[model samples]
Target: MTVRYAANKDVQIAYEVLGDPATGVPLLLIMGLDYQMVWWPDEFCEQLVAAGFAVVRFDNRDTGLSTHFAKGDSYTGNDMVDDALAVLDAVGWSDANVFGGSLGAAIGQALALLHPERVRSLVSVMGTPVTAGTLRTLRYVRFGTVAKLARLPKAATREQEIDNLVTVYRTVASPGYPFPEDWARHVATLSHDRHPRDPGTTVRQNAASRRFTVPALSTLTRPTVVIAGADDPLVRPVAGRDTARQIPGATFVSYPGMGHNLPEELWPDIIERTRAVAR
Candidate 1:
């Protein structure tokens, strides 16, 4: 994978492209929370590529190799939305199909709402709509609890960091799907050794999400799909359903016994749904 940087004002966003850019439909994948673009899974990207899409996955600002903010620096959710647009511009695509998970989904919603001309289609996976009412519902209660509990203590060593991530995944993983503890630990170790954890950046990103509020999604006109895990402890199915309901003609799909994490088994279904919506 050739990692490239896209300039969004002073901040530089890091991204990688999969598949033949010239031969397939352009699809942008937006990752959630403070998770790096690597969390999107190379296998998943390959499957999407095989399904005929030029997949572009990026690290949002304050995460991965992207521009990291100082402790007190502040940026709103709109900035993140604009950063997504900058990635598209850097990649020479005027518009592309967008698929986002969790916070990435929120960013996609804002992008489709504010810059409708730039989104050909959208797929929001495991995300809640950006509204006060939705945020206050029971759907978010479990997620909020898990999120709070997932907060890790300062790790003085790489091993501790990996352990923390493993614990978090184990805590939030779907009860039915086997939790890949060994693989999760390996990835966590690699990520921690590579970039280390930046709690400050995560706080800033969370602030942005908390402050953002989209009053109504009725104005969004692009073709949209919301994919949810039926057993998702974080960002429950209702959140996905509500997001789909708010947008005109948006479709919602649910996977049985799935959680916030996207398992490899669901890649085919996700790719098919994306193709169907984009069509």
Candidate 2:
């Protein structure tokens, strides 16, 4: 059965513990920005669990059922790292292999750098260390700039929200695959049920990201595998290449024509390949 553990602040951290806790290695999976733990995909998690790794996947603060901090409250990576550590402690796991996608990958990198002793191994998928003048950074800034210029913040109507969601769906949905409108609506309901997003929390998280850099990449000793989709528009192949190169003994794998989204067709291969890295 899935279990819930309380953070020190009394906020219940919900997690689904999979596989045998004592077999293979403990694997912790972290999701991306504003993404619920559900985004990790049940089949993918099950594949990992079946591969003999004790798997733990949880909701990060303000995303899933985790506690939502104040909108205006400022927080740093230290605070986030603390929350992750606390979750580990509450669950009675000292340390585990870390797998993070996108922002979660960034957090995994930070955890490896900040508390290397706590990480058994690391898999950073579609993540990168901060660097100036990189195409990735420039593209993110350009998108944010355009959003601000277009007055996207003034979107208050539910119609506007739907339009926003549809636009994003069009951009990211796998080609020829049907958009899961029902699933989107279901998730929207869960999002509202959990907690209304505080604009301040997002702002604070952005601030923390801005102030963070992966200088510690050179110091990470954990066995690391950096995975990237060659066609990813948000984070290009070069970014992943650079990240893998910076870390000693890190391996980089590129999937041709694969975009940011994890297509169901690739789940079995992705899961098996990722799990192999743990061995």
Candidate 3:
């Protein structure tokens, strides 16, 4: 799929679509930190389409083909929300069922809190709640994994970038499931060739996310599904369970041997639960 641009004030958000909106449920797939829309695997998206969804995947600002920002550039979390709304607007979807992964799931939580009407349903995968305080949020993360990530050697070329990405993903990959090195390489290559990622994007996104003032998750009225990986070394499974507990009647499901990565074997389970909530 080719990319399309949505104007959010001055920033141009990049997005792509699969399946027709008229024929299926409107679903926006938001990726996580430092990742682009291409990270949403093609086969995974085709499966979503086959499962009766109009899938729209997008690159957040300062990532992918979206408008870049300079170091020290400051933006409110509302800007991030507007960027998402812009993509939905450009796609002609007034509201959508959102499936967000990791940081993207946090963004979806923020969306649900800030503009509840705009979110039909939410599926949060391997993520913490935006409503959690800084200290609380920190408690859910494993700094050992973070420290290892921080220690990765910097990439100076295209090949180096792809290799680094593969390494990073492998670090958090499912221990019980076979790692899809080939698919990871293909995604890494596309991310590298599609548009070289700006080194500062992660910092900028983290800053913007921190600026968001989220209310209690208990306030959310929409149906939600929280999928946690029991083997996740980053955000602990308890976080998703806690998030589910906060929402009125949110469903919480976890898989053993599933780490931070989403193995293809679990797609059927994830999609079916998400479909139930969206319906």
Candidate 4:
């Protein structure tokens, strides 16, 4: 992946462009909270490329190789949304199809609402809208799953941290599919090597997410598709249904046996749906 940078004010957002821009439609990929772009598998990207898309994946601020923040410094959700716009400008694409996973899905919602002219379409998966706020957002979460995953012991070394993350991935992974342990480990290792695990970023990202509200989803005009893993242990399927219901003409899809983790088996279906949405 060739790394590039987009300046969102003083922040230099790190991004990478895959596939030939001249040959395929542009697809901006946003990963979940505190998760780097590396969490997006190269194989999945390659498949998207083969399907005729020039994929642009970026590390959100406070994650991966992107700029870090001080203990007290904070940014709003618009900052994160504009960070994406900066990336689009860097890639020279006026607009593109977008795919956001988990917290990314919420960001995508905000992106479409905040900059309607810059997004051709959006695909949101395993996430609740940040605009939903604290209490409303809590309704969609399964606390038992969160409690189990949160119980992992803290790690002092890189290897230990990788192990802890892999365990988290496995626990939330789809129950009916074979676990992609290798991909999970690779993502964890990259996440650790690029930046040591910091609990502060997670807290900050969560805070910014909670603070964002406006342009209620009903006012959104972009073509969108909300995907939910029917069996997700973290965010419930109803969240996806509700998100789609709020947007006029938006499509809602739910897959049984899918969880917080994106199963490779569903990639084809998602890619095709993206093609339809982007059109």
Of the two candidates 1 and 3, the one with more favorable TM-score, higher being better, is 3
lDDT of 4 at 109: 91
Scored by lDDT, model 1 comes in at: 0.84
Ranking by lDDT: 4, 3, 1, 2
Q: Give TM-scores for every candidate, taking all chains together and pairing residue i with residue i.
A: 0.93, 0.82, 0.97, 0.97
User: On residues 1-279, what C-alpha lDDT tens digit does candidate 2 reach at each position?
Assistant: 465764846556667687877665789887766666766666667877777777888877765677777756666655666667777786677888889887777788888888888888888887666432344455533254235334545448665554554445345444444555676565554554555445555566656555555455788899989887776655666767877897899989887766555766776777776677777
List residue ranges in candidate 1 displaced over 4 A: 133-139, 147-153, 213-215
Tens digits of per-residue lDDT, candidate 4, 156-193, equal 77789999988988888898789998889988888888
Residue pairs with colliding backbones in model 4 are none
Q: Where does candidate 3 stray beyond 4 Å?
A: none
List the global CA lDDT of all models: 0.84, 0.68, 0.88, 0.89
Q: Please write out the lDDT profile of model 3 over residues 165-244, one tens digit for every residue.
A: 89889988888799999999999898889788676887888777667787889998889999899999888999999999
Per-residue error for 141 in candidate 4, Å, reads 0.9
